[model samples]
Each structure stands twice: as structure tokens, then as C-alpha cells.
Target: MSASDNKIVNQENKNSADIITWREYEALRNEMRREFRTNDDELKSTVDEIKQTLDATNVTVTGLSDQMTDIQRNIADMRLAIENLTVLQQQQQEDDDDPELEDDAHNARGAPRGHRPRGWVPLGRNGRGQDEEDGLGKPKFSIPKFEGGADVEEYLTWELKIEKLWSLHPHYSEDRKIKLASSEFDGYALRWWDSLVRNLDEDGAQPIRTWRAMKEAMTSRFVPTNYMRNIFDKLTLLRQGVKTVDEYYMEMEMLMQRGRVRESLEMTMQRFLNGLKYDVKGIVRHYTYTNMNQLLHHAREAESQLAEEAKVKGRATGAGRFTPRSFYSAGAFDALHSLLYSA
Candidate 1:
């Protein structure tokens, strides 16, 4: 009886122990699963935060790129504007012939009334810078009287002076310009203008309303018909003569400008060559010259060389006159031999 009871009790005890072990193992597995779920949720939240940060960063980068592009475009527009302004300034300089009218007499806005600075003169109703209050100041300059004449040079000089004066006072109206120039006319020129005006009124034609029209009328009447032909004839017969190369070149250039003659570089060079003295031209023709300046430079060298040779010959002849006669010289011996043979 005791052995069996003890065996049964032991079996029951073992079964209880096995049940307890299984319960503990099940509780541990459930705890581990809950911990894994918590960790997985935290990882998902972290990943979402990282994705949001990347999206914000991308938007910021795109905005910065657009701003950079706009800045570049603005810079290009500014550069183009500078280039155009520079071109305009250069053209203005060329047209004005570097006149002293570049300084501003007053501000961009009109000057206050009754402010007259030193060396500043008021514009005139009849002519430039006459004593009158036009509310503007210009540097004082004189316009010469044209007074019609047979001297074409006089007319040309007067016209040039008028044009330069007008360039200084570009704000002048066309009618003002015509009247200002007409006021300076005297002698035959005044009579011509008066006669032209009367003829215009009689024909009911508009009088010379612009400076350009006035110039055309005056030039046609004052410039002789054969004046241009005379210039051409002189050019055709022009030669260096006693003048130096520089003098000849300047005269030729002046004549060409007066005639408004345009020629190819080769043709101009040939004309210049043909006008040179024979000795200089012979040396210059043998050399290769591409431009007129080069030709002129070579011609001058040739002239100088010829001049030096002539000076040396003069010096040698003078020295020989001072020295005693040398009968042993080849030329003297030949002469002496000829004389003896003829005798």
C-alpha cells in the first residue's frame, strides 16, 4: 500500500511541474511579441519623419534654384543695356568732333530762373548765345559772317563753322537755325537771301524752313559750276615738285576730301606713286608697300637717302678742291693719256 501511494503522488507532482513550466513559457512568448510590436511602431514613425524632412529639403532647394535663374537673367539684361549705351556714346563723339559742349551747363532738370554762372551766356532769339534770358545757358561761341563770295574756301569754312556751332546747340529749332544763319549774312549773301525770299513769296512757295534747305540753296548758288572740275584738273596734274613727301601727301588728301572722291587703296597708292619725284619714285616702286602710309614712309626714306647722297657729294667735291691736284688718279690719267695720244 505505501509503495503505490508514493508512486502515484510522484506522478501527480511531475504532472503539476510540467503544467507550470508550460504556463511560464507561454507568458514569456506573449511578452516578447508585445515588445516587438512596440519597436515596429517606433521604427515606422522614425521613417515617416525622415521622409517629411526630405520633402521639405527638396522644396527649399527648388526655390533657391528659381531665385538663381532670375538673378542670372537680370544680370544679362543689365549687360546688354550697358553695351548699347556705350555704342550710342561712341557715335555721338564721332559726330560732334570732340567739341567742348559736353559739359552740362545746368542740371538735367531746367535751371532756376536768374542763375547765371561765370562764362555762361544766354541763348539769343536771332543767334547763338546772344544776351537774352532763354532760361538756358551755353558756352559763348562766335559765328562768322558768310557774305557770299567767289572764294569757295571762304564759303566752305563758313559752312563748317556754322555746322559745328549747330552741333553744340542741338536743341535749336529748324526755323531758329535758318534765321540765325541768315542774320550773319552780309554783302552779296544778304542780297541773295532777300531776293530768294521775295521770289518765294511771289511764287507762294514755302520759304527755306530748315537749315538743310538753306544750305542746299546757298551751295547751289554760291558754289561755281566749274569749281569741282578745277579741283579734279589740279589733282590730275598734282606732283611732289619741291615739296617734301609729307606736304605732298597732306595736299593730296585735302584735294580728295574736297572732291568727295573715293578710290580703292591700290588706286590711291598708284596715284600717290605717280606724283612722286623721279628719283624717290624709282626707289619706292621697287619696294612692296601695302598701304598709303607705308608708301609714304618709304618715299620719305628714299628722299632722305637722296638728300644725304647729294650732301656727301658736295662735301667730297669741296674737300677735293682744298687738296692738291692728284695727276695719278685714274680719271686724270685717262684724260692726260687721251690728250697725248691726240697730239
Candidate 2:
């Protein structure tokens, strides 16, 4: 082969190699572009998913915020309720502790200044009429007024009524009990209480805080010194006379109570027996009795038996059926005889 032919072949070979390398480079560039486009598309898809996740997170955060706000409001309302309940309990405690009748919002607690509350007879010093309801809008139990009187029995009855009032409604404090009792006073009784209070205040003496003290003061003022002596004298001189056993017993019992007598059961029984009529006392003395009740029972039975015997005797003699004409005078008898004949 000639050197020139060889050179031409080498050149052709080089050219062919060059062309193959160029084609391979172009293919590689195209592959790289396609890969880049695919990567870009995948990145864009990831970005869209991230944006959707962010939007969902925002919605969740908003919902959680609203729930937190509601929880806070509920907590606030619970706190308010607790505060109100505490206040109510405190108020109730105050009402129960106070002793004096002071004015409050409700009528049940007390009366207005210097006046009696509902259901109680007011002092009427302020010229107010009786009230039906107490401070708390509840009806009060009616208590009778106590006007001072000279009769010891009347005062005792009034005092007994006052005691009964306390027993029925026992929640009163010591001071309140005294105040309530005084509130029922009217006329002379009211004046007496006012004077007592004023005198004590002026003398710088301790106020009457107890019912016992008030009762003592009242007894001293209303009851005469010789009242008990008079009652005792009447009791000592008592006799059954023409009265029945029950009537005699009642009179003796009243005298004892009025004089506040205290004696042994035996002595009391004997005293009661001694007061009975001769026949009744004779029978009762012979009976076996341990107490006054037994003695009285025996006495009453004896009296009843005697009465029955008398009634039988009168019937047997026709004395129970006697007419007025039997006792008429001679002149009266003639008038009746003439009138009957004429008729």
C-alpha cells in the first residue's frame, strides 16, 4: 500500500470516530435535560404536598385555639359560681349567730330598729301595728300581748304563755328571748319595762341578759308582798261546806298553786283530807292511800256513795217528788183550791 492511501484511510477513520463521539455527546445532553425536567416535576409535586400540609396544620391550630378559649370561659364561670356560693354561706352563718333583733333584708332575722318583729306583739312604742310576717317573708307564730295587772294569777297565766312560746320555738338566744318577752308588753307592762331599762342604764348596772333576771324583776314589781300571806290564810281556812268533792278539791289546789306552797306529800295529803266535809273526811281518813291523788279518789268515791244514799232515802220517802203546794201558806192554799174548783 502507498503511504498516501494509508493517510487517507486514517483521516476517514478519525472523521468517523469524531462523528460517533458527537452523536454520543448529543444523546447524553438529551438524557441529562430529561432527567432535570423529571427532577423539577417531582420537586414541584413535593412543594404542592407541603403547601397542603401547611394549610391543614393552620386549620388544626385554629380549632385548638377556639377549644382553649371555650375552656377558659368555662373555668371563669365556675370561679364565679364558687364565689357566689361562699358569700351565701357566710350570710347564713351571720344570721344564726346574732342575738339581738336587728333589722335585716328579710323579716325572719329580726324587727326594725326598736320594734318587735313579725308574729310577736310589737312594743308599739313607735306606733306601728302588728306585722304578720317576719323579716324573712315567713309567717311568724302569734304571741299574746301582756299588759301589766295587779292580779298574781293573771300574771302567772301570762308568764306561762310566754314560757310556752319559748318551748314551741326554741332557737332563740338568751338576749333574744328576753327581748321577745319584753316586746309583748303593753300599757302598764310596757311602761314598767321601759322604766326598768332606763333605771338600769342610769345606774350603770349590767343589763338584764337572762330570762330569770327579767322574771325576778317582774315579780317584784307586779306581785304584792302580802299576796302569798293572803292566799295561805284562805287555804288554811278553806272548807268543803256544801260544795261537791271535785269543787272543794279544785279550790284547795288553786290556793296552793297561787301561794307557791311547798310541803311534804304526807302533809299535803292530810291537809286536803282535812278540808273535806265530815262524812267524806271520815271515810277518806280510814282508806289506805299513799298519795294525794289516791286520797282524793277515795274521798270522791265516798261523796258519790253518800249522794246516792241520800237520793235513795229521798225517793223511798217520796220527798224527791214533793210539789210546791205542799209548802204553800194557808191563804195561798185557799186561793189555789178556789181557782181549781172554778176551772
Candidate 3:
């Protein structure tokens, strides 16, 4: 009876222990599931934070890309600007090289192809038709164009025409034309020409007011200067030598200017005709020339023909001067030589 009771009690105790262990195991399993759930939630939060960081980094990268694109555009614009500036500099350099665009103050570097130089443009502002300051800082005046002349009135007239072309301002008066007309000529007269000049008044002490007055004064004192003495002298002396017709005519024109004489075209033509040598004058004397230009043209033509005739004569002399008697003489000698050989 005691052993059965003890065995049953032990079994009941064992069953109770098993029930307690089962309940503890169930609680541990619930706690482990809660811890796992908490860890998974923390991991999910870390993943979300990483995703947010990646999104922010992507946004920054997009902004940087936009900035880089802007930088590239700015660089391209600068390159374009530099290229345009280079083109402008090249254009300016080309303009500077152009003859027409060269500084007008330089005038011409040298005379035109075949023509003799007109006048040397003095260095600096002197040749720009500008008023120059003298040593004492005073305004120095000079004739714009006075090569050299004996006739004061004609010379002044020519200078006035040049002044008009330059549109130069005059020192004397506000009006350029009136100032030129009233310019003093006595000061500019050369020694060779002025030596013969005599004053107008009885005492000859007073200065003339203008060039016109000076000219009138001279006219009274030196009307043609010994009558036709100088005129006839020049006409007789004038002759065209090796100089071209233009050069010859220029010399005659200068003579005319010196004498203060203006002849009609016909009178000039006759003067030129009378001055020529025998052969040349004879050819020109027959034509009733209306203009000196026409006479010069015909005279040049005759001169050319005479030159050709002389050249033909020279050629004929050169070809036949020391030649043998005939080509037939050489042939006769050859025939005699053959006959001798045959004998």
C-alpha cells in the first residue's frame, strides 16, 4: 500500500514540474519574439535613414551637375568673346596697313610712279598746313606753296589758288580769300628779282598796304622792264633740247610767269613755232594753230617721224657701209675656182 502511494505522488510531482517548465518556455518564446521584433524595427529605421541620406546625396549631385553645366557654358562664352576680340584686333591691324587708312599726317611716303616729287613734306606738323610756333613761341607764318617766282603779282595769285585748295586759314584777316588777296609780297621777293624793283613814291620810303598795291607800284616803275627787252630775249633764247615737250613747255611757262605776261593760245603757239630749229620750225610754221596744245601735238608727231627717218638711215649705213661689191662677185669667184679645179 505505501509503495503505490509514493509512486503516484512522485508522478504527480513530476507532472507539476513539467507544467511549470512548459509555462516558462512559452514566456521565453514570447520575450524572444518581442526582442526580434524590436531589432527588426531598428534595422528598418536605419534603412529608411540610409535611403533619406542617399536621396539628399542624389539632390546634391543634381545641383553640382547643374553648376558644372553652367561653368561649361560660361567657359564657352568666354572663348567666344576672346575669338571676337581677336577678330577685331586683326581688323584694326589690317586697317592700319591700308594706304588710304594710314595717318593723313604722313601724306605720301614717296612720289607717284614716274612723276618727279612735288615737294618734300617736312617732318612733324610743318607739312600738315598747321600753324607752327617759332623759337619764342610766336606763330611763324610762311607761304604754303611758293617754289620761286620773279613776278610778285602772278606768284601771289598762284599761291592764293593753292591756299584755296588747302582751305588754310590766313593770319591777316578772318576771311581767307581777302587775307590772301592782301598778303605782303615785298618780303618774299628774291634777291635776283627784287634788285631791279624800284619804290613807288617820290621819296620811296612808305610801305605798300597790300600785294595788289605793291604790284600797281611796280607796274608804274617797270612797265615790261626796258619795253620788250626781256620778252624778245626769252623768245629768242627758248629752245627744246633733249627735254620732252612737257618739260620744254614748262620752262616757257615759267618764263612767261617771270615776265608777268599772259599771251593768248595762238600767240603762245606762234612763239613756240618761231623758237624751233630749221627742220622742226619749217614743219610747224605752215599750220594755223588755234591752241598751243595742238601745235605741240603736231610738232611731236613730226619729231617722231624725223627720229624714225634718222634711225632708218642709221640702219642702212650699218648694213651697207663696209659690205663687198656684190653677192654675184662671190659667186663668180666660186665658178672660177671650180673651173681651175677641173683644169
Candidate 4:
């Protein structure tokens, strides 16, 4: 129990307390570091997950945008198709509503009850013909007959007769007496029973059969020469000659309108000027005239002046050029005037 022993004990006790505090502080620091590490790892995992989710979201958004664009395009295409179909339907309906250009028989017959004329066929119902089964009526018109394979005139006449016969009657049975149109044949329909022969060439009227084909052949054969002949005749015969300026212009103008000249307006005007009686043409051309109206106006003025000058010259001398009042021309008057004046 001395003072020194007490001091030593106190020192040991302080040392033990310091050692305990150091241990506790070290443990707390270690635990805090572990917790910080755990928090950092958790934060890193969360960040990584968020990054993956963002990448996936970007991909999904891009796909959706592309899909939306494609959907928009498809919608646009559908709208256009619908609009076109609507317009086409409307036009078809309009055309359906419009009356057909035909004989009044279409209206006089009245509206159809069903898809077709109701009941038995009219020609059968009346029992008018020799056979009710056949649609043939009394033959009001006769076929003028044809041997076929002829010139344009003969062929044309024969074709017209066939047309007339078909137009007059609704049907004709194929016999020696009469023949009908057929699709199985080269031409039209066969109203009667089957042919005994399979490949019998139904000569419905050969060399020219179908109306279109016949017309085409006829036009090619006959029209070209006739067209040329007309042009030649017009050119040879049509002349201004002694006609007045207005008369000549009007004649040429009429011919021009009728497409007789088949040339440009300038060329036509040139032809008309060439054909004119020289005196009117010369003075009119001397003036500035770009078109027909101006040309006609100037020509009339010049013609009047020529007539007046001719009248003056005729009074002074005995002879002259062309004039309405007298048979005097400016050219002859000029010569006579020069002869007398020179003397």
C-alpha cells in the first residue's frame, strides 16, 4: 500500500483504457469502410442496370418510330387507293345514269322487269312468224344477193344490203334460205342447230365480212384516189381570175375553212395573193399587212384608187386598164398618158 504502488496501478489502468478505446475505434473504422464498399458496389450495380435499361429503351423507341413511319405510309397509300376507287365508281355511276345514244326503240320498249325482258320473247308471244321458236318476222326487206369477191363498189353495195337485212330482222336461222351471225365461225352467230360438218367454213359473205374490216378495206381501196382527185380539181379549177378583191378573198377564205388548201395560213394567203387579178394584189402587198383583215382592207382601198385613176385616165385618153365603170386598166392608161404627155 505505498504511494509508488498506487501510481503504478493507476498507470496500468490508463494503459488498459487507452488500449480498449483504440480497439473500439479501429473496429468502428473497419465497419464503416466495409459499409462504404457495400454502398459503392450497390450504386455501381444500379448504374449498370440503368445503362442497360436505357440502351433497351433506345432500341424499343427506334423500332416504334420506324413502325409508326411505315404505318403512316401504308395509311397514305390506302387513302389514295380509296380516293381513286371512289372517283372511278362515281364516273361509272354517272356514265350508267347517262342515256345511251340509240334509236327511240330503246325507250319505247319500256324498262326491263328483270335482268331481261319478262315472259316469253315478243316475236314468239305474238306467234307472228312461220315458226314461233325463231325470232324471225315477215321479211319486209330482201337480200340483193352476192357471189362475193368483187370491186369496192360491188362489195360496198353488197355489204350495205347485208347491213339492211340484219337491221330489219332480229334473227335468221342458218339454212340454204338464210344465214345468221356466229362466233364459232369466222364471222358471227349460228342461230340454228349444230353443223353436220365440224370445220365447215361458214362463208357469211367472204372477201369482206365484219363491218369494220369491210369499211377499212373499202376506205383504203376507194378513198385515197378520191381524196387526191378532189385536191387536184380544186387547185386546177379554183382561181381569183377577174373576181373582186373581197370576192376573191372570200372564195379563198371559204376554201381555207373547208380544209381544201391543207397548208399554213401564211402559205394559204400567199396562194390567194398569187391567184388574185394582179392589180389588187400588188397594191395590197405594197402596204403593211400582216393578216387577212389588214390585207383585205388595203386591197379594197388600192382597188378603189385604181378604179378612180382608171376613170381619170379614160376621160383624158381613149383606152386604159380594168375598171367597173368602164373596161379600163391603169397599165394601159399609164402607157397612153405617157405617150400623150411626152408629145
Candidate 5:
């Protein structure tokens, strides 16, 4: 009986111990699973936060890049503008250094050389004149037919007809006409016959006022003093005769030598006549007036003496005694007469 009881008790104790150990192992496994789940959740949260921070940093970098691009564009534009301004300034400086450019700019701006562009009409050789061209390339005024018979009487008759026609106009006063005629004749003083005649044809009884206006207009067209004197001499001859022309020309030369006539006239008839001769044909005519025959002879003698003096002195002759640079060649005079006298 004692051996059976001992065996049963020992078996029961062993069975109880095994049951307790199994229970403890199950509890520990459950706790470890819970702890692993908590740790995984925390790691996921930290990873999410880091990802958000990275995204924000990327956006900031992108924005900074865009701002840099805009700044670069602005800098480039400023550079281009500065370069253009620099080029323009350089070109202006270059133009300032050039006299021809200055002249061209002045002409383009409608500033005259000595006189205003309005009062004096530019004439060409062959009786052609230049007028201001309109935008359509047509001249502002047409050239008038001024050539008539070569007879002085015929010219005078035409002039009288024009004078009479002018008289009919309300703007033309008889007193003014008489005064102008007298002034023209007197101004010519038997020297500037051709100039006188031409002026009469163009201006008639308004020589003083018209010529003065022309001169005023020509203020921008400044010419050399010697050139002015030559013009005055030429104009005097046109108005009067060669004798007066020579006298005036000589007087002007003397004045120039004495420095008395420096900058006397800003513009002169000779310059106008030269321009006309170069531009217009038939504007200036050469003829040996019977009244000027003696004067011409004396001028020839004086010219000869001047030439001889020049040869002896081994220097250039005075302009008055020398052949005219612009007009008054023997051949030119003969040609003019032929053209005038030709039927």
C-alpha cells in the first residue's frame, strides 16, 4: 500500500509543474509581440516626419532656383540696355568728331550755309533749278521759261509788261515800284547791268526790299568775305555794266587788302550767280553791251598790266585782274551772246 501512494503523488506533482511552465511561456510570447508592434509604429511615424521635411526642403530649393532665374534675366536685360546706350553714345561722339557729319546734320536740320533756304531758290546749269521736293518726289515749283529774244529792247519790253502787270496787283504799289526801279539802276551804278536786268526780271520794283529779304533769308548760308565780294562785283555788273563791276571788284579787293571789308557781306551775288551758273542754264547771260565797250577795253588793259605785274613779281595776280574763276570767260561771253542772239 505505501509504494502505490508514493508513485501517484510524484506523478501529480510533475504534471502540475509542466502545466505552470507552459502558461508562463504563453504570457511572455504575447508581451514580446505587443512590444514589437509598438516599436514598428514609432519607426513608421519618424520616417513619415522625415519624408515631410525632405519635401519641404525640395520645395524651398525649387523656389530659390526660380528666383535666381528671374534675377539672372533681369541682370541680362540691364546689361543689354547698358550696351545699347554705350553704342549710341559712342556713335554720337564719333559724329561730333567729323565735320562732314556735322554739316550733313545741319543741312538735314534745314539750317542754311549762309542764308535761309526759303528766300533763295537754288538754280542749276541749263536753266534748271532745284526746288524743295514734296513727299511725292515732285518739285515744289516748276521752272518758268525766261528765255526770250536776245534783243535788249525785247527784254525791256517784256520787263515793262511784267511791271505793268505787277502794277495791276493790289500788293504792288506804284511808289514802291518807282523807288525799286531807281534803286536797282542806282545800285547797279553802270557796273552790274546783267545783275540789274536779272534782278529786275525776278523782283522788278522790289529790289531793295526783296534783295534785303533774300539776304536775311541767306543768313545761314555764310560765305567767305572774298567770295562775298566776288558776288557783289558780279551782281553789280549784272545790274549796271562791266566798268562798274570792275570798279567795285577792285575796290573790294583793296578793302580786303586793307582788312576793311572783312566779314562785310555774309552772302554776295557772285556766290549766288556761281551757284546758279552751276545749277541753272540760261540764268546768266554774257553780252558785250555797247555802253560797256570802253570799260571793257580799259578792263582788258588793266588785266594785262596786272598779268605783267604778276609775271614780273613772280606771284599770283589779284583776283579782280585775273580771269574770273566762276564767270566772264571770253568764250563763255561769246557763247552767251550766241545763245541770246540765235533765232
Candidate 6:
């Protein structure tokens, strides 16, 4: 009873210890597996969030890039518009010479006979009086006339009078007047005469033969053609080299200073005109500005009027408010301003 009973009790104690150890191990393993599952789910969620952020960032970058491209395109277009306007202005300047030819042609006809010539001469024979015949008889060209009472009759009487005056004037030698008229009108005689009505209206002159006389008087007052040609050459050179408005302004300012002329605010404006001319000749083919031409014309008028006023006043009057030179400067300022401020 003593030895056998003690051995059995020891064995039972060992068996109980082994069973408890096995249960503890199983519980620890289950806890570890649950923790790993939680960590894995957290990692997947973090990765998905990062991917979403990356996609959003890409979309934003792409949109910004597209907007930048559009802005660049607009800038190019504006540049082109400015360039085309310049070329048009140059063409107009060249055409200014044509009007002189018309004056010479009018003078060459000599005195109008007190009566119409024999052939195709309507001596009030077309059932109209002399005045009415004069109105209807000359080759009727449908042309624009002044808004006032300057119709066909008025124009015909004026033309006849001018011819008579040309014949009588001390300076008008028959041959010289003919040559001068021919040289002045050249290819543009009829067209120049047609344009005279508008010119007269603008200048506040009455539509009469005296209009031609006034023009001839003015032409005589100008410096020779060669002097103007030299001015044109220099202007053209300066216009072509300037890339930016600022550069152009500086050059013009220098010119004014050298000429001993007070720097006009209109100089700034002239720079703008030059910029437009440059843009027209250089950039217009590549880019388009719808109103560039009109802007250029306005600038030109402002410059011309300012210059005239300066001449009349005996000094620079508008210099403080708008420097005549300012016209030239405005072109560059506008270009840069557009580039910076535009959306």
C-alpha cells in the first residue's frame, strides 16, 4: 500500500501539468493570428489612400499644364496682331505721295474754253441749261462727295475754275503746270481727285478749284522728296530692330534728345505705333489681333496731331499730360502688361 500508491499519485500530477501547458500554448497562438490579421488590413487601407492621393495630384498637374499652354497661345496671337498693323501703316505712308500727281494733271488742261469743245460737247443741247449741262455732261464717275451740297454740278464748276486759275497764275507756265500735274498725279490722278472730297471735308475746306490750289501750295511748302525719303529710311531701320517696346522707347527718346527737342509724351505713343508696325510686318502672319489695325490708326492720328500742335504752339504744350513719345512706349508696356495680367 505505501510504495505503489505514492507512484500513482506522482504520475497523475505530471499528467495534469502537461494538459494545462498545451491549453496555454493554443490560446497564445490564436491571439498572435488575430493581431497579424489586423496589421494586414491596416497596411492595405494605407496603400489605397496613398494611391488615391497620387491620382488626384496627377490630375491637378495635368490641368495646370493645359492652362499654361492656352495662355502661351494667346500671347502669341497678340504679338501677331501688333505686327500686322505696322505693315499697313507703312503702306499708307507710301501712298501719301500719289496726291501730288493729281494737282499737276489738273493744271495741264489749261483754261477751260468759255464754251464746251466741239466734239461730244453738250452746249445745253441735251435739253438742259449750261449749268445743268455741266453737271450731267462730263464723264459721270460715281464717287463719294462731301455731306454738304457738293454734288456733280458743284464739282464740275470747281474743276473748270481750277483749270482757269492754273492758266492765269504767274507761276503757272503752261508746260510746267502740265509736267507738275503729270508728275504729281502719275498713276493715281483720278483716284486722288476722287479722294479730294473726303480730304476737303476733313480739312474744313470748301469743295472748289481752290482746294487743288491749296494742296499745291502746301506741297510747295514741304521739304524735297529726298529729305522725306531719308527720314523714312531711318524710321524703317529703327522699327525693324526693336524687339521689345521698352527698347524702342529708349531709342526714340534718344532721338528726341539728339534733335534738341523736348521729349514728348507722344514719343511713348509713337513707340506703340512702331510696335504695332513691327507686329504687323513680323507677327501678324503667325498671330491675329482683330482690332490691331484700328488701334494703330488711332495712335498715328494722335502722334500727328500732337506734332502739329507742337509746331503751332511754338513749344511743346501737351508734353506734361501725354508725352508725344509716350505713344511709342505704350506698345511695349501693353505687350508686357498683357503677358502679366492676362489669365
Most accurate candidate by TM-score: 2
Per model, state how many residue pairs clash. 0, 8, 0, 10, 45, 43
Taking the tens digit of each residue's C-alpha lDDT, what string does model 4 give over 1-343?
9999999999999998776577889999999999999999999999999999999999999999999999998997797688656644543443334343122225435656543333322322332212323322234455464433324344445555566666664233222123332211221112211331232336422323234553454346434566546556676467777777888777766545333347776876677677766777778777886876776788789889999999998787765444644524436667777899999
TM-score of 6: 0.25
In candidate 2, which residue ranges exceed 4 Å CA deviation?
A: 1-140, 151-153, 166-173, 319-343
Estimate the lDDT of model 1: 0.77
User: Could you tell me which residue pairs clash in candidate 4?
Assistant: 181-188, 181-189, 182-188, 182-189, 183-188, 320-329, 321-328, 321-329, 322-328, 322-329
* Tens digits of lDDT, candidate 6, 73-149: 88877866665455334323422343432343334334375633333223244322232222222222222222223
lDDT value, residue 150 of candidate 5 = 32
Kindly give the stretch of ten consecutive residues in candidate 2 with the minimal lDDT sum: 130-139
Regions more than 4 Å wrong, model 4:
1-224, 236-238, 257-260, 316-343
Better of 3 and 6 by lDDT: 3
lDDT of 2 by residue, 116-195 (tens): 45544432232222231221212256667888977777797877788887787665445556767777789999998999
Q: C-alpha displacement of 193 in model 5, angstroms?
A: 63
Q: Which window of 10 residues has the lowest lDDT sum in candidate 1?
A: 100-109
TM-score of each: 0.50, 0.51, 0.36, 0.29, 0.27, 0.25
Can you tell me which runs of candidate 5 are displaced by over 4 Å? Answer: 1-23, 104-343
Pick the lDDT winner.
1
lDDT of 1 at 259: 68
Residue lDDT tens for model 3, 84-173: 566445434543454432443244555565544443323334332222111111123544443344554555465546455436433222
lDDT of each: 0.77, 0.75, 0.59, 0.56, 0.47, 0.49
- Which pairs of residues clash in candidate 3, taking residues 3 or more apart in a chain or in different chains? none
Between the candidate structures 3 and 5, which one is better when assessed by lDDT? 3
